[model samples]
Structures are given as structure tokens and as C-alpha cells.
Target: MTDIPRNPLIDQDVWTGRLFGGAEGSWYTAGETRDVTEPATGERLTNIGLARAADVARAAKAAAAAQPAWAALPPRDRAAIMRRAAAALERNLEHTAHYVARETGGIPAKAQLEVAEAATQLHIAAGLPLQPQGLVLPSTVGRTSYARRVPHGVVGVISPFNFPLILSMRSVAPALALGNAVVLKPDPQTPVSGGFLIARAFEEAGLPPGVLQVVPGDADAGAAVVEAPEVRMIAFTGSTAAGRKVGELAGRLLKKVSLELGGKNTLIVLDDADLDLAASNAAFGAFFHQGQICMATGRIVAHRKIAAELTRRLVEKATTLPIGDPASGTVAIGPLINARQLQNVDSIVRASVQAGAVLEAGGTYERLFYKPTVLSNVRPGMRAFDEEIFGPVAVVTPFDSDDEAVELANRTEYGLSCAVIGTSLNRATAIGDRLKCGLLHINGQTVADECVNPFGGRGDSGNGGSMGGPADAEEYTQWQWVTVKGAAERTPF
Candidate 1:
């Protein structure tokens, strides 16, 4: 193993196998540790402590204990703290971006984007508490009735390694704003930058102790967080398979769970669409961050009339994207998270080619750096078209008509997001309205997400619950109806 150089951006002492928890700002060391490696160079960045099941329980208890005081504070007060946290995040943006780039194998530009998105999410969540909650109901002559939103006490957040900061904050910020305490477990692969930095931001922002806990660990720790009795709700973002397991466990415990899972997102281009714009956006949506996004465009449905031109343009664009070390600043695409992911992507490409899909641009790799790949002639039966290929590979299939386009788009079990590109906005809107996905983009890519939008999916992509804007506050809370009766004029016989 290469000797990892010290990163000026991170506190070496704090990052070496320490978990953050409690209001006293204490750090605890676990019995076992795991080495975190940089995928760009296969160098061990640092050893992270793995939290055990007991640790999860302890953190949950602490969050539960701290929730009441946090809930007791006025919404504006909570909002103030959240805003301060956002400011702290902005102040540390440079360091955080560097850490994210190195740890997650994302290019500096994408890492910076992630940090910016996280800060924006925090700022948006700050305003959630100020939004109107519940409603007054018309009642009988002498009675009044109303419903109010209330916190769910302790919320467990399980975030994936890819886009860890944004995904975690999707739940943590909203949960905090709604007066619920949070116990966060970031993916073990990206504990320091993805998990620890957010904890530090909150601590520096003067959040009360114990209200927020950051525990970094493997699957055991994740299961513990789900099984903990004190965790009233769980907000999870990961693979569809893992999400099912979380849902099953949380269901057994009768805990409310919100899941954001995998997607085989589709991007459709009509015959009248500008081929250049469609190809460029498709390349961006498919290859951005090595295509490690849930909303990445995995499948492209194009009108048969323009399919050849669109495929040619996409292939031309894919070959020019820089793929190298993330820290170099000039690279566009970086390494996959690990060898397993690299193998998974390569195998999928190889299998699709063997199954009769034509590889138009890229189908090669050295170590973890995969070339941006575009596969044409992809049919319905090919795995590349049917499954979620979480890599920089775009599979294109031709559709004869608008009805055929909608049919092909909705054929997949996953309905997370879809994009429609066409010359006419009215035509695009007409097609988008017919799509079954949770999110739709007209004349754009499928990966765009706004800070104020309720972000999530439908069908296997997620539950009906969303993760941003005012809807998030509702997701993290419960409703309680309060009724008052005037003095009775007569007694019952």
C-alpha cells in the first residue's frame, strides 16, 4: 500500500477511527477499524472506526433523549440553527470538496457541485419550519377541531456512498427542522468526508448535544440502526435490494420508513428534437459522476427517424470526456468507488455486447477508470436495457411513435425519473404528462433536481413520500388532531 499523504483539509486526529455523538461533543473509538482507500490511486486514505450494534443503540438513545428539548424550541429557533449550519458548510466548502473528491473518486468539479447542493439543501430546510402546518376544520356549533404536525422523535438516516452529503442532508436537515433528532450512518466507504464533515458542521453551528449523531460503519451497524427501538422512523437512500431489506426490518418494528432506491431512468428524444442538444444532455446525464447517480440516464429511447444521428452524436461526445485522477482538476470522469463496481460495470457492458447490443464508443477500462460507453441497437431483452447499470454507459433503443416511446419508457419496473426532449414544448409536455415516473424534465436531462422540489420517485423507485421542500417536513412528522368542546347545555339521560 502506498503511504497516504496528510490532507491539509482534514484534521488527522479527528478522522482516524473516531465516531461523533452526544451533546458533550465526545468521540469514541470502536473495537474494529476499516481502511478507506482512494479509488483514483488505490491508496489508503485513512482508517475509519466501525460502529457496532451497541453503538447504534447508544446513539439512538442519545438522540431520543435530546429530541424533546429540540422539539420544545420554537420553529424559528431551529431554523436559525439550520441556517448557521449551512453557513458553516459554505465556510468549509473547499476542504469538504477536496475530501469528497479524494474519498468518493469524483472529479473536483462534481465534488464541488455536491457540496454546493448540500449547502442549498440546508438553506432550503431552514425555511421548512416557517411553512404553514396542518389546518383548521369547520366543526359543530359548540366545538372546534384542528390538526397539527408533530415530530417523530428519533429518525435514523442511512446514506449511500455516492452523493453522500446531499442524500444524508435530504433527511437530516428536514428531520432537524421538524424538531426530530437524527442518528446518521453514512456508507462505510465514505465516512470521513460524507459523514463526519456534516457532523462537524452541526457541532460548530452550536446545535445542542445529542440531537445529532454521526456513526460510520458497515452493514451490521446499518441493521442496528434499523432495529433500534428508539428510532421512530428511518430515511434510507441506497440500492433497491438493500432498500427492501430495510423496509422489511423497519416494518417488523412498526417504524415509518422512507426509501430512495435505484432507477433505470429513461431519456427520450423525439424526431423533431435538436439532435445536438439531446446528445449533449444525454451524455451529461449518463456519464456525470461516472453515472453513479440514481437519476442517471441509463436508457435512451429515440425516434427511429433520428436514432442514427443521435447515437452518432452521443458516441462523438462520449469519447472526448477526460477520465483520470480526480485531484488533477482537468479530468471529467473519475474512478469507480472500488474494484467490485468497476467489474460490475465492465461485465454489464461485455454482456450487453455479447447479447447483440453494439458498442458504439467506449467499452474499456484500466483499473477503476472506465471509459464513457454508449451502446446502440439495445433491445428490450438486453440486460443493459432492462436493469439499472450504475455506470457511465448509455443504451439507445429506437421507438417508432410517441405511444411507442411512452410504452418503452414505462416498461421498466423502476420509475424514478424520466426526460423528454422535443422541438415543441407542448409536445414534450404532452408526452411527459403520460410518463409514470416521479420526476420529469421537458427538453432536458433526467438528473436535474431543484432545492425546493419534492425529490423522490414512484413504484420501485420509492414510496410516495418525498425528500425535499415542504413535503419533507411532512414526511418526517406525524399529524395529530386536537378538538375542544364548549360547555354542554344539557346532560345526557
Candidate 2:
């Protein structure tokens, strides 16, 4: 806030140069620093410490040191603390959401939606502490046997820039609720709303210092988390290529891992589908938060009979969504997260248009503000169809039959979410059955998530892991088999 102009919304105390290592959420100022940028204006937001491996090691050490006592707390007691954490997050929603909007260049509405969802994650996790954590097993040897769920001790989390708060909390809150201490490394792009704000919430809620670490850092810090011997598991949300690296490194260390990666999601419009319903879902799915969501519909496969009308409708809607800076609190869509993302979106659009996809509505940008675009006659091989363009672009490809629609949808390496829109529930259900995605919607859109429901992806989209109370119970803990015999049973050697 000294040289960099203080934003009226973003609190200066949260954006300072101090880095909060996981060691009880204490400030660590010994490191090289980098500037956080406001994507809309290409201006410096604030300087933050650039964390190296040593910083992560310190956090891991703290988590490992603090985990046992946290785990020793009564289950109901832990639940009480989790509820307090959720309340703390709720009280600070508006204040932290301002940081999310400015830092990610997302509309205020979108930022608030994610912030509210993040708090919901904590609330849902608050119920996990009292759930039965072990199963009674049958023993053939006349000995009582049991399988008990135990904390992995320390968990390392690496969250992505897009949808930062919820993604990080989806892992962090549950791990804490289930008694595993966590060291969270939020994406360097959105450290405050993603990392610092979460740390502040938990600290205010009286979570033991060192139980949840917030380290805003780069790849070196993430790698250190995975490599630390004291850290028993890794929960990462990022790109597929990056997920692969995290998986490989964690595998070599024989550690537990959960990865939520990229998506090239689709929505199918049957001949029987209402054109208005299909077009509305397609536009919202493709352009919400500038299509930065992992569940954003990248392709719309419509019946040949209704494809033209659907495309026309999408084009009409696309031109009407306001596009500009979110700080103004007026636009539906805001700037891309950064210059590189802007370039990537533009390149894919240009290449797809050159390959013969009709640029029906939008294909231009002013600075980082890429217009909500709709394309028709898109094919499987085109860049728009093949790559995950995490931008506000929608592509429509016509399918002659249900079989062909299923074929077109399953062709991608990513199988995250799919929507089948038709009046007939039976018909939609059949088509949804043939699709290879982890999440399916019938007579609905692909962009949806509820904290209580098991949500995840398959193949490149994720490692078949989910985020919910039940899924969290499985992912955050390890099972130990215990057997007991009267008077010390003897075994022949």
C-alpha cells in the first residue's frame, strides 16, 4: 500500500509483503518477492514473498508437529471448531470477496458466489468429525478385528488460480475436520482471497496454529510439499499436464494423492430439446466467469434439425452480455486472468475460425476483455473443439443421431461434465448413460456444484476422486487394521 495504490475494497493489511508460513500462520518475511497483478489494467496490485522449497519444508514440519494433538481431540470437539471456522468465514465474506474480484478479475457476483460456496464447504465438513470412522471386520481366528480410519498426519494442497477459494477449501476444510493438519499452497496469481483470507478465517476461529498453513507460492513450494516425508498426502487442483507431474512425484514417494484437473466439457441438444432452454444453458455454461470453470461447457452438440436455430439463439444472447472491468460492478463478463490466457484464448479462436468454424457472434478483444463468442459448424479436429479454451467461447457441432452425439462427446481426453437437454427424461437418461463423464445432467446445464454432493471428474479431468463429505472422509484418512486376542495369542514361527 506504500507505492502501490491502495484499492478501496482490498484491505491493505492482507496485501502486505509478509508471507504467512503454515507455522501457526505467523508472518515470514525472509524471501524474494514478486508483484501480484490486476489483470484488467496491467497494474501491480501488491508484492508477495516468492516461496522456495525451504518455506514449504518449514510448514510441513509444523503440520507434522501439530497433527497428533489435533487428531487426539474428541470428534465432537473437532466438529465444534469446524463450525466456528465456517462462521468466521461467513462473517468475513464481503470483505474477502472484494479481494477475490480484484485479484481474479471476476465480477463481484461471481466472486461472492465462490466465497459463499467456500464457506459451505467448511460447514459441510463440520459434520465429518462425528461420522463413524472405522468398520468392524469379521475375524476367522476368533479374534475381534477392526478397520479404523486414521489421519495421514500432514496433507499438502496445491490449488489453482481459477476458482481458488472453493478449490482450496474443498480439500483444506475436510482434512482439518478429519484431524489431518494441512499445508495449503494457493496459486501465486490469487494468494489473498485464496490463501491469506482462508488462513485468517481459521486463525480467528481458533484453529491451532500450524494446523492449517497458507503459503502463497510457485512450483518450487508445491514440489517441496509433495517431497516432504512428513507430508503424507497431496490434494492438487490444476491443469492435466501439471496434475500428471504431481501424480508421478507422489507415486514415487508412495503417498496418497487426489487431483482435480482440466476439462473440455460438453452439452448435448437433442432434436426434441426446447431451443430456448438449450440456448440459454449453452450461453450460461460457456460464458459464466468468462468460461474459467472446470465444468464450463466447451462444446454444444445439437441435432442437425435444430442446430442452426440453437446457434442463432446463442449468437443473439452472446452479443448482449456486458463485457468490461468488474471493478465497475456493471459487466456480466470481465477480463481474462492474464495476458497469457488472453493470447491462448485468441489463438484457439483464430485457428478454429481459419479451419472453417463460423464465428457467429464474437471473436475479438479489447485488452484482456475477450467478448463472449459463439461458433458454429465446429469439428472434432479444430482447436476450439480439441483444446480446453478457458475463455468465453462456445462452439456448436451438429450431430445426426444420438449415437453420433455420444461419439462426439466421448472423443475428448477430458471426461468431466456433460449435459443432455431434452423433454423426454427416458431419452436423456439413455444418452447420459453412454457418455463417459464423471458428472451428468439431464434436462439441465453442466455448470453446477453442491457442496454436499459428490463432485469430481474422470480421466484427464481428475483421478476419479470427488469433493464432498463422504469423499473427503475417504481421501483425507488412511485405514489401519487392528486385531485383538485374549491373553496374548501365540503364533508358530
Candidate 3:
């Protein structure tokens, strides 16, 4: 690899590796490599080695072979390693946060939050070893039985670009803690930042090789990892369309799959709710990370009495957000990942305008920086109202009552997350329950929090994977029931 910058983070002599067992601290480099560019400016950030299909297969094979040894280790021992890794991450908090911000265009404060969250997830996963709970099936049909959770052998993780480090950690930590070997396929855009940091920490903590492997490449490389027979389970987090493709391949291989896909999440505001707080939080949730999050509040449904007031407050808040370089502490907004995402956001906003939505503020696009935009009077047939824009754009619509608001919220096919704002706790809780989403927030905006429980979406948003609690550890595993009926009693028929 050629050196473009003298930054300490960039590794010269570009090398990739199969981070599975028996190959402790081994470097595997493909002859081909490419340059990674920063979104804000077209400067070269780093040079990354692109792993091919063959490299993916080899990584999977290594993980598969290492599974038995990893699973055989005592749960406490495994937990100790994970806890050490978390400690290591905590020590290097500054560098980790800075690297994520520089590469992913995330602001310093937000990036710092994600780094801490990643560490907390590791800490939570560390607790999994001591909390293995199983159900007793006392004498079912003349046989005493019980159900136990077991590792699913070699599992594959396909992560997304937005919130790369935290989201990947959310999946990887639990899988590894549950005693399963993991082959992590990081998003190509922000690959070096997340996986590289994790690998370094794991090595420093003396984690067993092959327990966690990271391969950085494009879709072809990801597909190779998913299609491998050695990979028994696939945990994917990305767009709904891409999730479908990965699901299809996993289905052909009869592999277990967990998907957390796209969403057009809604922030419902009632007439009697706190308009100022809701507007401020809604602005942050809708535009944070350039509105690329799966659970971002892309659609805002407001009660008619307060719709105009909330819209006015939201537009005012969006206008004042300081947009600048991601590294600057004062800058709250950052550039989009690349040109494609910027253009996609632009196209969707244009369509929303054509469908009767009125622009509230900020529609200028200069390079990767698309101004934080808000639209009013958005109707059903527009792409912005229903589709995952994946950019800094929000579509606002008004509803008559709670029933009509719930109906409008569920109008889209995606069901990842939603938020309700109201003065009455009982009414808000009741509305939250009726809303069709994996996670519902009352009087507060949604965020990917480690302490809070995580649930995957239904419908096109994808389903069946969680990252926080004891149940998260169970999801990464399979089950095996063994019955020892007094050594079979040598029963002869």
C-alpha cells in the first residue's frame, strides 16, 4: 500500500487477515488495495485492502474449525476475556472516538457517545457467562427434560455504514460472548475504523484467535462470507433491499438469519404535548448522522391543532444547528458519507416537493454537505413520506386525532421504531402499545442505547435479533437437549 497521509492511524503495507483460531497474529494481504476518501473533503484518509471471495471462505473455514475450542472454554473464562476487551477499549477511548468521527463524518460528541456505548455493550456481554438461564421441563411424557442454549458454531455479521463501530459491536460482542466464532463483514465505507480498533483491543486483551475475524471489502466479499457452508448464522444490519439479497443466500444454505433493516420511523406529536421539547428532540433525531439511521424519525405526524407550531419550532431548530467539519467540537452536523447518499437525499426531497410537500428550510447541496432539510404538508404517494431517505431530510404531515395518527404512522411497510409525545402518561403508554414497532418511546426521541433493550423490526424493517440483555446472548445461540435416563437402563424389548 502507498502512503497518502502521515496520519498515525493509517497502516502502511496494507494487510488483511483471517482473525480466527490457530492463526494468532497472522497478516494476510491481497495484492490489490484502494484509497479511502473523507466525505467532507476529497482527501485520502487511508488505504484499505479489499478481500475477495476466496479470502472470505478462508476466514469462515478458520472460524468454523476454531468453534469447538472456543465453545469448550468455561463460561467465566470467556466472560473474563470480553471484560478485558472492554477495559482495553475504555483506556483508548479518545483515539477510538476520534477515528470514528474522522472516518464516518460523525460529530465528536456523538462519536464519543458511540464509543462509550460500544464499551458498555462489551461489559454487558461480559455478564452473559454467569447468567445462563434454562427452563426445566419436568417429566414431559415419561421423560425428564430441559432446554439449554448452545453456540451456533460459526456466525457471520454483515454490518452497515452508519454507526459502524457501535452497531457492529452490538452484534459481535454478544456472539463472541455466547461462545460462538464470529466472522464480521464491516461496511466498506467505514471498515478500517471499527474492526481495526476491535481487533487491536482483542489482541491486547489476549483473546483467542479465530473467535472474532474481520474482513473488509464490498458486496461481493460480503456475499462470499454469507454463502459459505461454514457460516451457520448470519446477522445483518443494513438497507431492506440488501437484507433481502443476503437472506436469500442464507436461505439457500439453510443458515439462520437475523436482519435489522431500514425504517421510515415517525415522531407523533399530540396537540397537548410539549411542543418545544418535542420539536427540539425531533430535529436532533431526524437530522443526526445526516438522517442516515434506520430508526431515524424521517416522518413527523402531528395533531392539527399544534402541527403548524411544531413545524415552526422544528424549522427554527434545524436552521441554527452548526454544520461544519466533523472534527470540530462546535460542529453538530457532518458531511454525508459520499456523493451517492447526498444525491439520493436530494432526489427524494425533490419528489416530496412534487407530491405537495412544502420546504421549510435548508435545501442547498454543496458536495457532501446537504443542508438539513424539512418538508411540510407531505402526503402518502411521495417517496419521502414512506421510503428510507437515508439523508438529512424530514417529511412533516398532520393527523386529526390519536386514532388517525396511529393509522398514519402504520401506513408505511417499515416498522422499526416510533415515538409518542403527550401530557398524559396513560394515554402515551396506550398509544405506544398500539403502534406497530419494535421499540416505542414515550415523550422522548429514540436512540440506539446499550442500557435500553434492543429489538429488531417487523415487515420490511426485518426481524429477530436483539443486542442488550440476557435474551440477546440467547439469540446468538442455538439449543441442544440431552437426556440421560439412567444410562438408558439397558432396556431390552
Candidate 4:
């Protein structure tokens, strides 16, 4: 296995390989590279190759050319390759965590978790090739008929910087496993963990040439992926605004598109609930990974009877949590991904406070480490309530009844996930039924994902493109109906 070089010497060719068959992206030959800076310290981690629109088109064409042979391989052979790829990916997890921590400003634990989850996704993808691809159907003419799922030829993937590894792997692994070629365009902010590493793993596991093309790039490469005729489908994970643009372009080209967009999720607290447990769950949901997750609880709608107490608890927890360079020690929260992100988060906090929300705990920062924050009296029009903060800020509001709670939870234009806290499962389930998000957690936090459960959003959050077993089957393949018989069939004409 080609170990991801750990020397930190920033060798351009070593980190960003220029080979076409998954070892390197096509853009490196042009000698135009982008600086990947560490968010925590503003240190230049490495200079990664940048992909152009032409490079994306080239990669897509290569991936399309390689699909037939890859699909022709036996399913068992494909599955074995997938398993080996999973193993190869596992070998790099430990060192990869350090890189992720530095590049993305995530704590060691968060980085480790991302690596572990990425490996798990690969393991799940290993079985995708072996799963039954078709269903037997009865024919009107008494002929043996069936419907089979076939690969989409080439899939173009555009991933984000936050949770880079798992987000990119979930789509790449399944598409590759189901016999589809892929041209991956990871966010330029996270080329290493999101693009090159996964491609290298597959290549090391004996994947044939041209099956996977890694393109680490910015908007030009992303636009090229959607516009390239060879890419039959698009799997994009990013902000809602960007996702809408992707969907628009893919739609114009008549391409199959799966969009995993942003979220302004919520967690509802009941009057009869345990405030301590609810507060704990809310804190983790709102501040975990510094609330950069799509499923992070953006708003906490508590019962008016207990809103004050919950707000106090949240404030206490937020004020005490450690904020520093996560690579230096065990900090509860790390820096924002970059100065841009830090400014955006700060703006939201400042705007909300100006718009009448009370900042109970924090609303300041030193460098990129924005303190975990708590805000009370937040209303729908405030930036903290309406916008996706994508930071370590929890906005608490009060709802008088279950109906009001449901109304508050469902008010956001984005509907990705929601959580309900109540004394009994039946009570929570009753409240959960009214919330109109794609994923729900009764008496739990909103941040969760597994191989079995479908992951996606609703409304502005996404366009019904989810990731899971059933979703993988549908997203990675197209349907075809076939009929066979001993005798010649009659022609309708």
C-alpha cells in the first residue's frame, strides 16, 4: 500500500500525484497549486494541485471510458476489491486523523471519529456489489421478466470541507462498489482527506485504470463536473445555495443529481422532560465538531415552563467548555475552518444580539477559536434563528405547547433533522410525528448517521437525495426492465 506520506515536508508530487488512474489528479501537470492552510494556526500545511474545468472534463471522459470493463467484472471480484480497499483505507486512519485535525481545525477525537466513520462507510460499500440488483416481475404475456439496476456510467461527486473524509467516501465507495466509474471533485479546502486518499486506497486495492479520477479543485472544476456530458449523475454535499446551483445546472443537462445540502435543524424540549439530560443532549448537538455538522441542533425550542432553566444550564456548559488549538490538547471546541468561517459565525452572533436576542454566555473570539455560545430570546427573524450558523452557537427559544414546538421546528426553510425530548417514548413519538424533517431522534440529539439509516434533508436542505442502503441502491444505479422466453415474442407494431 502507498502510505500517505507523513513527513510534512510538503512535497507537491508526493501528496498530490498527477497520475490519471486515481494516484493523482490531472491538474498538477499545469503547476498551478493552492495553499492548504491549517485553520487553528494559519500555518501553510501544503500546496495542493488545483483542477480546472478542462481537467474535470478530462477526468470524466476517462472515467466514462473505463466503466464498461469495470462493470463487466464479476460481482464477487468487485466485492473483493472493495473489501481490500476498505482494509487499505484502514491502514491510513491513524496518521490521516492528524492531517484532518490540522487542516480542518477539528479536535483529535473528532478527526479520529471522521476517519473511523470513513472506514465504516467503505466496509458498508464492500457489500453493495454483492447485493441483489434486480427483482423478478410477472409479465402480462406470460414471459419471464425482471427489472435490474444498472450503473450510471460515471458519477461526479462534489464534497465539502467539514467532515471531509466520510462525506466524500459515502458517495465514492457506493458508486464504485455498484460498478460505476467516478470523477471526484472534493472541496479545495480538503483535497487530501476528501479526494486523494480514497482514490489512492482503491488504486492500491487493485482497482483497474480510469475507474476513479480524483480532481481536487474549486468552482471551475465543480461546474465542469456538472456540465461534463460523461458524468451521468452528480452527488453533491455542501451549502444550500451552492446545492441549488448544482441542481439547476444538472437539471439543465438532464443529469441525475443527488444533493446533500445545508440544514438549520432543531431540538425540542418538553415540559415533562429531564432538563439535565435534555441540556446535555442539546449541548453536544449544538457544539459537537463546533456545530459545523448539517444535523447539528441549530435551534433549541424548549417548553416555556422550563426554558429559563434549560437556558441557564446551556449557558453554564457553554462558558466552561475549552476553546483552543485542538492539536495542542484536549479542547472541547477547535477553531473554525478558516478566517472566513470565523467571520461568518461572528456576524451571525452579532446580528442576533443586535436583533434582540440575549447573549448569555459568549459572543467573542481570539484568533479562530470562537467560544461555544448560548443565546436566549432568539426569534425567527434573527440571523441566529433564520440562518445556518455552522458554528458553536446554540440559540434557545421557548414554545408554549407541543403544537407550538412543532410549528417552531418546522418553521425553517431548511428541514433536515429534528429531535424531541419527552418523558416517555410515546409522548416524544407523538411530538416527533408532527415535525417535518427527513430524520428524527426522539429523546435524543439531531446529530446521527449509520449505514442502515437514510441520511438527507427536506425542502431547502436537499432534493430528496439521501445516503443509506436503500438510497445507495437507488442513487448509484438506473433501472431497466428485461423480458425473456423460449419462443419469440409478438411485436406490438
Candidate whose lDDT is highest: 1
lDDT of 1: 0.88
For candidate 4, write residues 1-493 as lDDT tens digits. 2223462222346654352443233333534677778778877777667888877777888888889999999988888887887777577777778777887789989888887888788888888888888999978765899999999999999999999888999999899989999998888888877877776677678888888988888888899999999999999999999999999999999999999998999999999989999999999999998999999999999999999999999999998898888877578899888788889999999988999999999889999888999999999999999999999999999999788888888888898999998897898899899988999998889999976678888899999878876789899999999988888867998
Please list the C-alpha lDDT of all candidates, in the order they appear. 0.88, 0.87, 0.80, 0.85
Winner of 2 and 4 under TM-score: 2
- Give every collision pair in model 2: 22-213, 24-210
Error of 3 at 183 (Å): 0.5
lDDT of 3 by residue, 163-239 (tens): 88887888788888888988888877887666766666677677777777778778998899788888899989889
Query: Cα-based RMSD of the predictions, in order?
Result: 2.1, 2.1, 2.6, 2.8
- Rank candidates, lDDT, best first: 1, 2, 4, 3
Task: Assess the local accuracy of residue 384 in candidate 4 as a C-alpha lDDT between 0 and 100.
Answer: 94
Better of 1 and 3 by lDDT: 1
Cα displacement (Å) at residue 483, model 4: 1.9
Q: How many backbone collisions does model 1 have?
A: 2
Q: The CA-based lDDT of model 2 is what?
A: 0.87
Q: In model 4, which runs have C-alpha deviations exceeding 4 angstroms?
A: 1-13, 17-28, 140-142, 487-493
Cα error, residue 293 of model 2, in Å, equals 1.1
Per-residue lDDT, model 1, residue 217, is 84
Between candidates 2 and 4, name the one with more favorable lDDT.
2
